[model samples]
Target: MRELVFALDYDPGWNTLADTLADFPDARVRSLSLHATADSLWRVDHATGSPDALSAIEDAFLTADYYADCLATEPCGADSETEVLDETDDTLVLYTYWQRTPVCTSIPHLALEHLGDGLLFETQHEQRRHTWRIIHPEDADIHGFFDALHAELSADVNVEIIRLTGLSATNTATFSAEEGTLTREQREALTAAVHHGFYNTPREIDLGELAEELGLPRSTLTYRVRRAEAEIIKQYMNHDPVSPSDPTS
Candidate 1:
């Protein structure tokens, strides 16, 4: 379950963003979430990195300063002008602005150093500003995207953000079908068909609905299911038949 993240500057813009990942054929970025603050020009509220999501940037806490502070308090959410607050440190982090809250500085259940690692990657002489970023799973086919982003911003920014709040550190895919029962595609299609309520009693599901759920055109699904049905019927009749499309006839 590898993932990609992009935490670019607010003004760098999406053309620059697209230019950065232009080579990746499978890149699936669909939207961007914009967050506006009083002082800074703008920040990447969030970005798309999933098949199920378009784009959404909400309140994310990197330190204790924002831990207890209410996010989404404004109508426009974390992007609102009225939600601005004081920056007490050279830069604002959790305890630096929120006082001695244990959540930021000292939580026995977790090591604060782990959080700090992602916040700022440092060398003796260099650091980069970081922010929340996301990459679509479809974007993984574009291996160059991440490398290009790192190269493009390495000279100017101290840090960049990638979203993991919804991603699994590891994914376990379990298929219920036996090896002879179905092909991987059928197993996947069946699971997706279940998403359409195809197995439900009323037969209320539309073929288009099942196709959409399975991420295929209804015509393709119809062809596959018909072929499969023909096979099932032949097997039930204790006879074998060449596939309709097979040319060995």
Candidate 2:
């Protein structure tokens, strides 16, 4: 399999959803699941933010203009609809079903047309940027798909290719600290770092601040985090699946 990572930046006036996201910079949206066929598409999206932001996003989802702007296609037909599957003060889950696939120019449609089936997609939306990660068969026509994507996008949408890499079947292995893949201290440090937004863009907290919060020396915290990260990456690269228990037992 091969993986492709890319991002799309939408100009403020060109996309209602993007503009709304830009208005609430702290809000984020992620695709929880997606299923698309030649004639239809359905997806579940999760959004997290302040209540006001969530409200605004929900409003956008209810509007036909948002779908039109998002898919870069004509307005949704009568058969299309969106439902709020769940909602809370700071989070919203939406399920959308679209039946007008023939007029849609969404990424999924384009991918299905050019890349064939069995492609896995992960997406994240923040501010005006939408990022996509696609894992597809090794024999897929990646360049052709890229060209089709560019051709389908509007002039106001800017696209960037972040990565294109081959993946071994085992490279999909994941790490679980609870399975003894990481030492206790390392897990704690890593958890603290993430909880404090150390990995966020423009980081919400610095290493020194994180160390102070954890009551640890800066170097100690740094070392633990680094070691934890190294272990996770090693597991991913080495395809060493962390089993919950000894299979031989």
Candidate 3:
């Protein structure tokens, strides 16, 4: 198998969903699951941010016009619907079902057309960037897929190739850890803290400042950072290996 990882950096003016993400730099959305056919797409997404950010994201996602505009196609107004599966101060889970005609150009549809079936997709969206990781057969036409994706996107959307390599057991284990070991919120908190020098002796930023920057409550940010630190320390001390029973492996 081979793994293809790429990112689309959007000019917010071209995509409303990306525009909303641009407005809230601290907000992030990751796909829990995605299933797509020629005529339909079903997706479950997990989002992390402050209450206001989550509310804005929910509004952008549920509004059919947003999808239509993003896809640069005719409206799928009645053909799409979204449900809030769960929500909290810092997290929101959403399920969306969208029906599309062949004319609608979406990433999944493009993948189906060029890469064929039996491909695994992992995706995340944050700060006007959408990243996609696809695991597919060795023989998949990756070049064709990339070309098609470039052709489909508007001139303002920049496509970046992050990785394209033969998948190894080590890569599989790494992907498993990334998707399973840390919750999205935990990862986000830990990343922000580390980036802003929360661990430095002379800290560059305090916990409260980091919390404010992330648009998360102080207590909530503290909990997530603490939990993430504990998890990292445990993993280091125990030298835990990716389990043989792991589904991804």
Candidate 4:
């Protein structure tokens, strides 16, 4: 199995929340999940920013061009089935269901659906980056897939392959490389934290120092490290290899 990760840049004028984020460059959208059915696309968008920025973010969706087919929209800060949709300055969540459009009209989603079982669409930001996990079979034509994808994208949009794994003969791991792994930023933050004695008894480096080293704001670094640690702990505790009775555990 092979996984391909890509950072997709969408047109500024497009309706993607990525475009809206451009309106507030400092704001970051941590995409929780996105799933597309035959008729509609469901997405959970999590955003964070200053009070003024969050105010503008709330208005972004209200005026978003992407929601033209939005059959129903539960605005952020409202009590609903979704838990994280809170009315806070630093955090906002939106639950959206969008009508499916043509391939030419929708750059990535339409192309992803065409891959069928050969490729799995993982996650995407409004205008920043999108990741996909592709499992290659012996008979699969990987090159052809890329060709078809490029044909749909405009010249301005750039696609970059961030990483590739599980191809060497000596490597016999059953799992796909990079499958369900921490994101690049998360990985870097966690790695840096460990090196700076973040997990040590005395804690050599604080959040401020770590954020400075990573060139990210203190808040951003805190979020990244926490999310990364949560994922690592989740994977370790849930993994099937460890037995409850094992002495190592």
Give the per-residue lDDT digits (tens) of candidate 2, residues 145-236: 76677677764465555555556544543334337888889988877877987665544676667889989987787667656654553444
- Lowest-sum lDDT 10-residue window in model 1: 120-129
The C-alpha TM-scores of every prediction are: 0.23, 0.66, 0.66, 0.49
Extract clashing residue pairs from model 4.
Answer: 18-126, 18-127
Q: Give candidate 2 regions above 4 Å deviation.
A: 66-70, 73-78, 169-249
For model 3, residues 1-249, the per-residue Cα lDDT tens digits are 667777776765777677898889899999999888878888899999999999999998887473522255345343677899999999999998878755666888778887779878899888777889887765565656666665676655655555555555666423223347889899888788779976543346766777899898887886676566445533432332345586754
Best by lDDT: 2
Quantify all predictions' global Cα lDDT against the true fold. Answer: 0.30, 0.72, 0.71, 0.52
Model 3: lDDT of residue 234:
36
Better of 1 and 3 by TM-score: 3
> Could you give the C-alpha RMSD of every candidate to the true structure, in order shown?
20.3, 12.0, 13.5, 13.7
Off by over 4 Å in 3: 66-70, 73-78, 172-249
How displaced is residue 54 in candidate 2, in Å?
A: 0.2
Which stretches in model 1 have alpha-carbon errors above 4 Å? 1-181, 239-249
User: Considering TM-score, which of the candidate structures 3 and 4 is the better prediction for this target?
Assistant: 3
- For candidate 4, write residues 55-90 as lDDT tens digits: 766776656544522212222222122234666758
lDDT by residue (1-249, candidate 1, tens digit) is 222233332212222223222332222222122221222222222222322121111122232123212211122222212121323212221111222222222111111122211221111100111233332232132223333333333222222222222233332222121246555566566556556665443233545667776688876775555344333323322322224574632
